[model samples]
Target: MKRRTAREKALQALFQIDISSTEPSAAIEHVLEGERSDDYLSKLVNGVIEHLDEIDQLIKAHLEKWSLERLATVDRNLLRIAVFELKYEHDEVPEKVVLDEAIEIAKLYGDDQSSKFINGVLSKVKQHLF
Candidate 1:
């Protein structure tokens, strides 16, 4: 599977975890069935969950006037995945690539403003982290 496809899966898994409050392991297993699973996608999903607090903090810091709870769940988690890729997975992925993929995902699964919102927040994250 392509990277964007993997990201879409990861986004869905994250969304599932958020909506159902299910365990990550089960959530991942449930989502990965019938789909190709790879180390990169696995790492992305698990890493985002593992570092959720830190990721959320970064997003929370960048989003002025919009709290994490107030943001749409899809937009919030999409930012989390992109930020995680930008920060912790830098060796394997480039910042622009992560941001681009995120913007595409946002356009598909998020509100009309999601792409702009994600870009703005991630730009701030890139400035601080890189």
Candidate 2:
């Protein structure tokens, strides 16, 4: 699968796991819809779940007056995946790429203001990280 498709599927799996407390592997399978899973997809979901606490703390740090749990699910998980990639996969993924991907995905799956909100918080997180 393309990286974009992989990111989208990873977000869906993370969403499922967030809402239902489903196992990360099962959530990945559910999103795969029986298609063969890609390495990037598994890497994204597993990486995000494995480091959720640290990711959430990063998000909460960058948020302005908004807590992580209060954010919309799509927005929350989108930020989580982006933050994970930014922090853990920085050697492989560029910061601009992670920020841009999260913004675009937020535009598609998040509320109207989600892209703007995500951009702001992630920019801060990026500044702090890099």
Winner by lDDT: 2
lDDT, candidate 2, at 121: 94
**Residue pairs that clash (backbone atoms under 3 angstroms), model 2:** none
lDDT at position 76, candidate 2: 95
- The residue-by-residue lDDT of candidate 1 on 19-109, one tens digit each, is 8897877777787886656676788889999999999998888988888999898998899899999989899899999999999999999
Worst 10-residue stretch by lDDT in candidate 2?
A: 61-70
Estimate candidate 2's alpha-carbon lDDT, on a 0 to 1 scale. Answer: 0.93
**Candidate 2 Cα outliers beyond 4 Å, as residue runs:** none
TM-score of every model versus the real structure? 0.95, 0.98
Enumerate residue pairs that collide in model 1: none
Q: Report model 1's TM-score to 2 decimal places.
A: 0.95
- lDDT against the true structure, per candidate, is 0.88, 0.93
Alpha-carbon RMSD, each predicted model: 1.1, 0.6
lDDT (Cα, tens digit) per residue for candidate 2, span 1-130 = 9888999999999999989999998999999998997999999999998898999999998889998889999999999999999999999999999999999999999988999999999999999998
* Deviating ranges (above 4 Å) for candidate 1: none
**CA shift of 69, model 1, Å:** 0.7
